[model samples]
Each structure stands twice: as C-alpha cells, then as structure tokens.
Target: MNAVTRIGQVGEKAVFRRHHRKPDGRSLFLYGFAKPDGVSLPEGNDPVAKGGELRWHPFRREWNVYAAHRQNRTFKPSSAEDPLAPSKPGGAVTEIPFETFEVAVFGNKFTSLHPEAPDPPEIPGVSSQPAVGACEVVVYTPEQTGSLYTVGQERRRLLLSAWNDRYEALFQQGCAFVMPFESRGEEVGVTLHHPHGQIYGFGEVPQVQRQMASAFDDGFSLERLLPQWSEYSVDEAGGVSAFCPPFARFPFEVWLTPRRRVPGPWDFSEEESDGFAHLLGEVTRRYDRFFGRDTAYMLTLHAAPKGCEQTFHFTAQFYPILRAPGRVKFLASVEQGTGVFTVDVMPEEAARTLRAQ
Candidate 1:
C-alpha cells in the first residue's frame, strides 16, 4: 500500500510524493513532477541495527555521539555497485526500489540516532544517554553523476521544497534542531559519489547553533552587518542575498540568506524560494568555473532551533576547502588547537575572482 500527497507546484508541473516502507522498517519517499508509477517494494535480507549513545564532553559542555556501525557503511563503490542509483528492471535492488524517480529520501541505515535507541551503558562518573533523533539521505536524482549545480533550476526548486517538508515533519516528530547539508567530493570525506545530501534531526541544538542563538539574543543583526560588505556581494534577487562574508573562515566561503530574517526554509516565501534555488546553483557553478574543475565543498543550512525561531536568522553557508586547484586549506595545529581559522585569501579577492566567473 502507498500514500500520496501533493507537495506543491513548480511552473506548470505539480509536484507530488508517494511513501513506501522498506523491508527493514525504514521509511522511503519518492518525489517528482508527476504522480509516481506503481512499483513493487523490494524485500531485503539485512539485519535491523540499533542506534548509538551520546556522551557528555566535560570541557566543551557538549555531547559526542558514537555509532560504531558507521565504520562499515558502503564506501567508494564502483558505478555498477552504486547503492543510491535506482534499481534496474531486472537488476539487484538498491536502497531505492523505484525503477525511475526524480528525487528520493530514506532513513539512513547507519544512523547515529534512532527513536527506539536503547539506554546507554553505565560508566562510573560519566554522563550519558540514548541518542534519540533521526537521520535521512536525500538523493537528488536517479542519475549518479553531476553535482547539485548541474541538476538544473526546476529540480533545485523541488529539492528545496522537499527539504522544507522534511523540516516540518521532523519537528512534528519532536526534534529540537534539524539541519540539511551536503558533503561533496573526496576532500570533504564524502563516501558516496552520488549527488545527494543528508538531514540530521538532533534531540538538542548543538554547540554552534547554541552560540548563534546567544549572539542573536545579544542583538546581532545580519541585516545591519550585510551592508558593510556590499563589495563582496555575488548575487541578490527576490529578497535574498548571496555574498562572501568579510570574516570568512575559508578562502572561498560564501553565505546566502534572505534579506529579512526567517526561522527556517519552511518560512521562505514563494519568491524567496525561487531566488534561493537560483543563487545556490549560481554559487556552486561559480566555484567550479573559478577553480577550472569540480571544487570540493561543504554546504549547510543554518536555521533557528525549534523553540528559538523568532530570534534567529536563516543562512546557507558554502565552505569550499580548495585554496587552489590542487591545494587544500587543511585545518592544521593552530586551527585545531586554538579554534582560530587562518585563511590564505581575502574575502574581497575571493569575491572578485568568483564574480569574474
């Protein structure tokens, strides 16, 4: 049995989604411009695994999660063994059972957290608890090649809408914080070559997010800060702005945010959504064109924690690790030890280079 929902519309095409449950009890959903064609869900023979636990970090005043199962996840598979690809008519079943799909989302098999996670083992003097949350993988397309930059405009818009849906769903399920992010290329330690991203729902807001909330409560305003770096702007349209911040930690770091503060992607107006998709594509294309190759980067969305929505500003930050075509800006001793980032290029110069692309 399947359940269908009307997601929204892009241009003249109406987007819809169909949900399925994998044999191991994982949830899967397929999204497309048209209704999905019926297909038999595959029955798998894998064992159901348990989730990990979180240990308190005394000094940092944070939690660290340990999921030992992740060490055995699929790594660098050949094209023939790409698990993210859609299953061929008579081929071996993959993570996605669909014969064809525009986009796919499913529960991560080696997730760090789970709703039914067992209680943590007792460690004499240490604080610990079950890591109860959610982790999901979002496949951008059926094709295994090409990055988000090459997915075309309409698909990117659909991707954004899908992310918005996930955010709302996860929050309703009791997550305190949700983050959608993409780790691309080997330099960024991406084990899969497929064009996909992941969404992590945390039981509590992490350290960085807590810091952002504190700064906002103390009167930090992105609207006031953005104007000081107008010369570093890359693109702005439909109430959104994409620019390299003057205090960039990476050489080619770029931050995209709506002109007016919003709690999260779900709060984006229709026009802001379109502009976001356009700017996301533009920033990535510029990175590839400027470096004369596919640049390795980490892309993340920063939104307010569930209860702190009114005080936080939403932003998408792109941190490309490449300082040059072949050189990487590794976080060495000074960076790791002192928490200070040392960059080799200035934000103005980086913006000038990207704009030329």
Candidate 2:
C-alpha cells in the first residue's frame, strides 16, 4: 500500500494542494498549479480573447473544442527557463515552487477547457456549448529532460499510482471521460520540450471512445480480439498484455490491456499495477531503441466512461509516428478527410520488428 500526504497549496486556487505519495517506499509529489509566488503567470494569447467553446460538426456528428488561446503556449524554451522544472531557492521561479520534488501534477496554464467557461453565442443550425472541463499537466520528474521510459522502476510505479488517484479524483470533479495522453517530439506537434504528459477531463465522451464502447456493446471481447489479432505476445506479464492490433493506424502502434476485465487504471490491484508499469516502461524503451533515436510518438490511456466500467476493458495505446529512421509518417488526405487511416506497414510486420528489437 502507498501513503499520500497533502503538502501545501499554490496560486489563487488555494484548494489545489501539493500531494506527496510513497510508492515502493520512495517519495513522490503531485502539485495542482505552476508559476511561483510573486511572479505573474503568463497570460494566454487569443487575439479574440475567446475562451474554449464546443461546436458540433454536422458531418462528423461530434463536438470539437475551439481553444484559440493555446497559440501563445510556451514553445521550446532553453533548459534554464524550462517551466516544468522545480523552482530553485534564489533562481527564477518556474512552475513548481519547491527546490526539488518527484512527480508533479498541475492545471495546464493554456487550457483547452475551463471550469467557468462563458456561454457561446447561438448560431443557426450549430449546436454550441461551453468547453467546461479540466486539463492537467503531469510532470514525470523534477529533472528537465528524459523520456518516461528512462524514469526508472520506482518512479514509473509512482506515476501509475498517481494516475489511479487522478482518475478517481477527476471523475468526482464531474468529468464524463478522463483521458491521459502524451505527445512527444515536434513531429507530434509537442510545443513543450519538457518530458510531461497531459490529462484532460472531458465533460462529454469523445467520438472515437464512444465508437470503441459501442464495439463492446456489439459483443466484442478481449478473448475474441486476442485470437484474431495478437501481434506481440510478450505482454502477458502480471495478467496485463500488450499487442499490436490488426487495425493500427500508425506504423508501430501497440495496445496494452489487462488479461482480465478491468475498468481503468484505478481498478488495478497491487501486482497488476507493478505489471502494467513494467509493460508500459518496456514498450517505451523498445520504442526509443527501435529507431536508434527518440521516436516521436503519442500515448493514450483509453478507459470506459464512468458508468460503463464492467462492459469495457481499459486499454493504453501507443502510436509512434516514425515509420523509418529519420522519416516521419504524415497523415494527409485520406486520414484527415475521411477519418479512415491508411497505414503503409502491416501490423504483423510492425509487431515483428518491435519483437526482434
């Protein structure tokens, strides 16, 4: 079992406290806000000064968020001015005020959703609503650099535990669906160079996730999928598994799931947590070595909506963009226009390549 201690609060939102946790007997801290005291937080750069709003796309029949404010987000800054780093005693204050800490979680300064979003002006034939939800940044480490793969066993375990805690917390905070995803490298459009991930608590379920849940309703189970499309069998450790599915969009996309039905990261037992951490870390490490460099990738945790826990199996998917060394796979016409992804490499070949390495 792990222990969590509420340390202190940061910013005007005093209720957002810094939480400390002990995973594998090592200490880890999670914060709720960035920007040190006395220093004003950077304001967003939306020329229209529009807060986020959700508009329904008639053709897609899904909601899209309009967050024009994110344009001014901090781009790749020098190592000295890295915002995710812990603030030093006399040094320029960054996000975290502590001189040193382990894992940290803070609300995104350039948020896509808001707790108090203004109502959108009514447009004829358009269903518009306020983008009301939460967006959080989870800092993997106090160190400015390194991928989640290199964060070590204890740290990784801490991260998993923290994620579990967050899943429960965010749901309680009124999120219909909580998504934790990481976008790495400039190819993936990652603005921040800092090794961190974002967790968005969506007020409504995204269309893709809704489609996956619908698949489960149509009698698709892990047992059926595994027999039909199992790419990597090396994921059978601790009852959780990872495999490259038949319909992977990216070159080397992999899906991680539990052998038994589990709703989300919070539902994992102690041993299952350890297993998932190992499997996830191993997958990431292999991905980095696959291209002989840090490959640009997107990792997402897909869990059932709050009510559909028993029916849906929680899974994590990784989509590394690089099809070959120094080459990136760009999603052009077919993928962008029709929502249908045309991948060049077969799942079998991609799985074989990853397994070989």
Q: For every candidate structure, what is the RMSD over all alpha carbons to the true structure, in angstroms?
A: 1.2, 7.0
Off by over 4 Å in 1: none
Candidate 2 local lDDT, residue 42: 29
TM-score, predicted candidate 2 vs. hidden true structure = 0.86
lDDT of 1 by residue, 149-173 (tens): 8999888988987898889889999
Predicted structure 1, TM vs. truth: 0.97
Best by TM-score: 1
Q: In angstroms, how far off is 108's CA in candidate 2?
A: 0.6
Candidate 2 Cα misplacement greater than 4 A, ranges: 1-51, 227-234
lDDT of 2 by residue, 20-112 (tens): 322212122353333222222222232323249999999999999998888888888888888888776666657665665667786676788
